[model samples]
Target: MDIKLDAAALEAFLRAEFPQVAGEYTVDRLTEDGLVLRMDVAERHLRPGGTVSGPAMFSLADVALYLAILSRIGPQALAVTTNCAIDFMRKPAAEGSMTAEARLLKLGRVLAVGDVLLRSDGQAAPVARASLTYSIPPAA
Candidate 1:
């Protein structure tokens, strides 16, 4: 399917719908099949041992896949995550930003499945990987 939302539109949607996280995440790149997103790392995103926290990385992955689906399906604010499986692969730099690359594996009438690869800014290796399923609200 063709993209229904670009990077700017996704950013605006996030700012409007999720103001709390608007400043932390950025829609960096939107491709035909996926998108790249970045999350600014801060004190709140770090854990003991000076690494990015798992929850923070998971959030990035979730949002990335959510936006990836929306990019193709248009703005579906009610789309909800039905399932998520994440693997914490490596320690992310405590002070670096985190970037997620998400690709849709499948997009159906009611469900969208995607995977996200997250890495610390400037890192070549991924720090986490996540697969998610979102239940899209039925069209009115």
Candidate 2:
């Protein structure tokens, strides 16, 4: 379960691959067990009710799990999300950043599965939970 991409590695990968979100996310920690990624939320992440939107949260969940999988398999950009299921359990803090903790459940040659727990900064309970399956492409 050792990470293929640590905090620094994830950051560098983001810069090289997805520059659009590089400034929005920060990798907090990565280890053999899991990875912790923090989202630097802005006013744009909120919606009409001052709650984080589903898409915004989903993106975090998706990317968090994706990064976690990559941390184990290395930078495989073609490793794409094949399936995802998420539960929106609670509303996040209106004006704060959020954190996503992701762990790989199974990593196979062609598919990787992981779960993500997302919470507003400093919150005790997760605002959302997600499970994702990624399709890993053949090494090229």
Candidate 3:
């Protein structure tokens, strides 16, 4: 699918629509596989074990897939996650920010399905993997 929004446009859309989380993530690159998003890890993102929290990683996966769909479908903030399943495979580096690579597997009229792989910056193995399904609101 053709990209409807580049990195700058996507970032702007997120900042405009989801200001609460826009600053936590950066639109790193948009590639053929999909969009790559980096989550800026802060103390709040860490768990007691000195690793990134599961929710933090899940957020990266969720947002990454959301942006991947928006990249193809335009900025549709109403698109909401309908279902999600995540697998935590490894511990993320506490000091390094995490990155999520999201690929759109299917984009239908009312639903979009995608998968995401997350890793701590510079890590070879994925820290988590997720498959997400989103319900896209009908165009107004």
Top candidate, metric lDDT: 3
Pairs that collide in candidate 3 are none
Which of the predicted structures, 1 or 2, would earn the higher lDDT when compared with the native?
1
lDDT of 2: 0.87
lDDT of 1 by residue, 24-94 (tens): 88999997778999998999988887888888888899999999999998999999999999998887888
Relative to the true structure, how large is the alpha-carbon lDDT of every model? 0.91, 0.87, 0.92
Off by over 4 Å in 3: none
Q: For each candidate, what TM-score against the reference? A: 0.96, 0.95, 0.97
Error of 1 at 33 (Å): 1.1
Please rank every candidate by TM-score, starting with the best: 3, 1, 2
Candidate 1, number of clashes? 0
Q: Write the per-residue lDDT of candidate 2 for residues 1-140, one digit (tens) a residue.
A: 76667778878998999998878888888857568888877788989978888999999999898888888888887889999999999879887799999988899999988899999987899999999999999987
In candidate 2, position 129 carries an lDDT of 96
Residues 1-140, candidate 3, lDDT per residue (tens digit)? 99999999999998999999989999999989689999888999988977888888889999999999999999888999999999999878998688999999999999999999998977899989999999998988
- Which regions of candidate 1 deviate over 4 angstroms? none
